[model samples]
Target: MQTCALAEELAADNDFILYAASLHPFARADDQELSEKERYEMIMQELQIIGRRFISQGLHVHVGMPDGETAIKVCNLIQAFLPIFLSLSCSSPFYEGKDTGLLSYRTKLFEVLPLAGLFEYMENWNHFVDQIEDLRKYGIIGGIRDLWWDTRPNPQFGTVEIRVCDLPVKFTSILALVALIQSTAAWLVEDVEGSSALSPYLLKANKWQAARHGLEGRFVDPTAILGDHPMQFRLAAMILKSRVSPYASKLGCDSYLEHLDSIISGGTGADHMCRIYQNTGDFHQVVRAIQKEFWQ
Candidate 1:
């Protein structure tokens, strides 16, 4: 199926699945999952081995925004929330049963772009255009091509593209993520400039927390200095509840919240995968199990 079709379908249910681009020859095309023993017998492996499995999918959400100012606002607000969102949506912790120490190894691979992480605050919409023009003028980088933030403006679709999620076994998770983004986008639209500003160091700290602790950490407020900030926590909750709840509910993602709860109670994707591998004493088996559940 076309990637757009898959994205739209997933959005309908707030779910997501792996979407392998044609560029990646290692990507599977409707390949079925093999049992752990069977995979070993056939010497079939995932992206790193003799054969590719279904772990190469990515969850990319497209948001059609008007212009650059809104994009900047949404990116800034969402940048702080990215860690929490990533923690909740994390699904791939082990590629082949070994503890990867990464909640979403897939996401780590994706962020290797030139424009990853919190972008510099572009003050005005005009500044956005002028910045790009200047970048092109000085040959600093390509035009508004791929500034590659966790979220970036896609002028072609007139939207912002969020590219930080791992492909879920089920598509509903991706849709939930997109709904969260869309609802947040609608909220940001109301505030053209921004509500408040936080130090860049604080925002980066939040990212580190997400990458390192996943769901276990009591996530620090990106706007706060560094320690326990109850107001920041409350404000973040309110931001998601008001901005994301309406859309998430509309997309039938009450279960999405449930999933987050399960992850919090048990562990993040990395934690659970590690537990599974250690308990089973078989790395290949874990991969096979993930493949069976993930691939049809």
Candidate 2:
């Protein structure tokens, strides 16, 4: 069976269970497929372990927009929501038998690169495309490499891809996330004018808070930058439950509340990590526990 098909049809049905898998050599479409690199081969064993644990790890979301411009608009509008998803979906809080304290530390590790984030708004597709062209022309950056944003445009598929969450151990999490992405795109296509514009700083601030607090964070209203008050997962949950539940339900994710309610009550992946730490007081033990619970 195709790996992707297995992920959707089989792995997710039983408690959102996703079999872990290793990550082997990563190749680009423009590059050679087979290589004799020594170091890459040396690490293949560990990579295979990762492969078995994650099964096939990726955040594959399909946006509803027809063009890159709309993708950009929707991406910018929903950038603020990315951290909320991250907080909720993070599962790899323990790594290599360690209590990292950081929820989804695996996901955050990608941010070490300059391009790993949702950046400042592009005025439009013209500007967006033009910037890439200029970067390529000047040799400053390659043409549209996977800049790991919380969300990014998949130009080839004409869909915006959001890479905020960690590898969901359960397939249902992936389905719920995809459903949320689809409904969000649908909402944007129909209600672009209804969204209030937020400055870049406030957006980043909210993301920082969500990363720290997970579902417990006090999210700033994107429209109310100067407002002293803060929003909570309670509000985010309400929006997601109302806007995303129906669509998520259709994708064999009828258990959408199972995922949402997990965060609502248990907090988020980060919250779970904290609980684990409090119990064992060891990072390595946490990672070991996670590896057992998630992979076995």
Candidate 3:
């Protein structure tokens, strides 16, 4: 909270205020600001037509693992739940001052990059390392960071980075997501034997559903026999609460986990922004409402 407050204060000092949505709803074509780094410059050049649109924010949660093998295992196991995280953190419904007709348009934008979106399933640590090495050897990427997968094994940090979530508007919602991700990772480490690797196609479809409809999307669980029928994503998330509760409690993040219920009942940040726009019929008013709600 102090970090956020300090950032707000610094921005205010410069006669500017922070807007916490994943995409800048009012950005223009000429708003493609480039960084000093060569890597970012190269990315901007490659993006060309979609350079400005590529500017979006996301929340990346890194959970430490014992080794690269464990990180890969958790990344594989957690693929099935990435969409749930995206659904909870959908805050990019508007883009370039227009309603985008998608809950998290940011997700779609990021996937436009060459090596972005869901990664191919890895068999183990060696499989992951070999792929990275090949990508570098072929000059396809400069480093592992170039593979912008939704979830990846960060060998440098000994962590599994979950990068699918939008930057949720409220700080508490951010904490809730962190608690959920950490607890889920802990649970995966303990019960990984019971979890199976989901098909990449199924994972991609589920992720697309989440990006389109947020909580209202349908999720197909291949693991369940009779329950293989599609169900609302919200219900699927609620069902997961029980499985992760013991881990959350053990992690002493039960209070934060409880906040997930508030998010589910109240709606995601995207839902809130959409409602505001619907009521006011003005994008400016939508942004003002978001700023007000964010500081509360």
Candidate 4:
């Protein structure tokens, strides 16, 4: 909250307020603002497609793990829950001054970059290291930071970084997401046998559904024995089955996890923005509403 207050004060000094939406609702795509950092310069020079679209933000939660192996295990175990997290935090419903008809349009924009989106399965720490080594050897990427996967094992931080969520509008929403992610990580660590072996195809499909429809999306079950007739469920239902409350209680974040129930019942950030636009019929009003509600 102090950081946000500082930012708000700074922006106020400059005659601008802090706008916390994932994507700029009205900025033109070609209006570029390049950073002076070498890596950012390389991104603009090499990947010419990334312009203002790359300016979008996300809420990345890093949960600490005991070892590299445990980080990899947690990354794999947490893959199935990424879509649910995205749905809960959807905030980029408008892009280029227009309603995009998708909850988290920022997800689609980020996926346009190379090495982005869902990560490939790794058998172990050794396998992950080998893959990164090969990518570096072939000049495919300069380092680990280049691999912008939805979830990755950050060896330097000894943490599993979940990069799937849009920047939610409310500060409490951010806290709730962090609590949920931390609780889920703890649960996964305690119950190694509960790891999900969901197919990569199913994971991608679920992510797409979440980006398109938020909590209203349907999730496909990978365990159905019927090969061509798998059962599907509402994303909210799948989220309830995750059973993270027990871990949250142990971690002393049970109250934060309870906010998830409020999010499910009230709607995501994107849903809130869309409603404001629908009522006012103006993108300006939508953005003003976001700015007003951000610190609430």
Candidate 5:
């Protein structure tokens, strides 16, 4: 929040218009009122295509791994939880001054970019490198950074970087989600056997549900492995209460983890924006609420 305030002050000093958005909620259907072309021109020529459509912000969490081998293992283990993260971080329900009726519209929007969904499972570091090399070999991508999977191995940093979450509107939400991600990733690194082996198909379905309904959506049952999906709130409560509490204690972030329960009960940031729009019937009012929460 202090950083945001500082940025706003700097923009004011420079006399440059700075519009903060996960994407421009007022101009989703029309680009005439936005600075899309201006943004595109500022990016690399090769990346211009993506930069043109990339008006959103996201929160990325990197968990340290010992090596590429461990990174790949951790990435696979954490993939199942991406949708849960998305649900809690959902904050893009409105687009183009209208309710899009989807939480985390940014999720679907970002996925439309090439190589932006779940990473293909790889057995080891060698397999992971081979797959990336093939993409580069075919001119499908220029480098590892171009393979914008929801989670990827950051070989340079020796960490597993998670990229599925939208930029949370509140600092509290950001802290809580980051703590959750770190705790879960650390736990998985220590006890890989407890992680779910959900298929890519199930993972995609859950991601779609999370984007569609936020926490109100149901996640595919990884526990049952085969049954009717359960409400995300129920699964989340079960996981946080049973599995993650110990990790929160270990990480010394128990209070932040507990705040997640309040978030789930109250609503996501996007959920809050939607309620504001519903009561006021004004899109500008929604934007004001977002700004307030973001700096709160």
Candidate 6:
């Protein structure tokens, strides 16, 4: 909260609003007052054709690893659970004064980018390096930094960066997710079996469900030890209760992990915005409520 307040204060001279995730209903692409070019610089001439109409923000968590090989392995293992993280952190529900009917509309908008969304499953560090080199050879990318996967290995930092979460309205969610990612990474590096690796198609399906329904949607549990697939909340609860809580305790962050229970039981920031909009029929109130929560 102090960091956020300080950022807002520092950016005050630049007319920044310090809003999280997507823009509010008041700002629309059709509005003449809005300038897309002013907000972002085009990375490539090819990108100019797309026109930056949609804007969104995400919370990226970096889990440190001992080496690039371990980071690659950890990133591949972490992809299956990215959807759960996304659902828990869903915050953008309203777009241009109306409900988009999606928990994280921002996720949909973000995946439109050429290199965005779930990454193609790679074999190892060598495979990743070869693919990146091929992209660079074709002038498709300048460096490894240009590949924007949902989870990517940051070779320079020796960390697997998870980029599948929307910026949560509550600061505590950030801490919880960071702990979740850190703990999960630590666990995956412990020589887990190949059964933990789900197909990319399955992971993508879960990602879609998470964006559409947050924690309310049912997910296909490919590795389900029991009969049927469980709902998002059920899987999330299982994770929190089984692994995250114990790991959090070890990391001295059990209290932070506890916040996930509230998010799962009640709702995420997107749900909160939807309720506020339904009550007042005003997007401004939704924005105000989010801002107020940030301060509190």
Which residue pairs collide, candidate 5?
Answer: none
The global C-alpha lDDT for each of the candidates, from Candidate 1 onward, is 0.56, 0.57, 0.85, 0.82, 0.74, 0.73
Which portions of model 4 show Cα errors greater than 4 Å? 194-197, 221-242
lDDT of 1 by residue, 110-179 (tens): 4554455666676666767787888778866654554656766677787777766555443444444566
lDDT per residue as tens, model 4, 36-81: 8988887888877664467689999999899988887888878877
Off by over 4 Å in 2: 1-60, 95-98, 194-197, 224-228, 246-258, 273-296
Q: How close is candidate 5 to the true structure, as a TM-score?
A: 0.86
TM-score of 6: 0.88
Best by lDDT: 3
Ranking by lDDT: 3, 4, 5, 6, 2, 1
Clashing pairs in 6: 25-97
Give the per-residue lDDT of model 3 (tens digit) for 1-296: 89989998999999878888898777765766677998778877887877756778899999999987788888888888889889999999988888899999999999988888886778888999999999999999988788889999887888899999999998888899899999999988997553456787888898999999999998876455215778888887787776898999999998988889877888899999999888889888877788778855
Candidate 2 per-residue C-alpha lDDT over 1-296 given as tens digits, one digit per residue, 9 for 90 to 100: 26766664574576543333111112122332324676445434434533223312345455646887787788777776676666566654554444545555555445554566665577788887887788778875554553546777778777787767665544455555566666655655665553444667767776666655566667775644224467685567556567655555554454644456644665554455557778978754544454445421
- Which 10-residue span in candidate 5 carries the lowest summed lDDT? 32-41
Tell me the lDDT of candidate 4: 0.82
Q: Candidates sorted by TM-score, descending order?
A: 3, 4, 6, 5, 2, 1
TM-score of each: 0.67, 0.70, 0.95, 0.92, 0.86, 0.88
Return the TM-score for candidate 4, rounded to 2 decimals: 0.92
Winning model by TM-score: 3
Tens digits of lDDT, candidate 5, 8-79: 789779974344445556664436434457434444365555545556778889888877767877887778
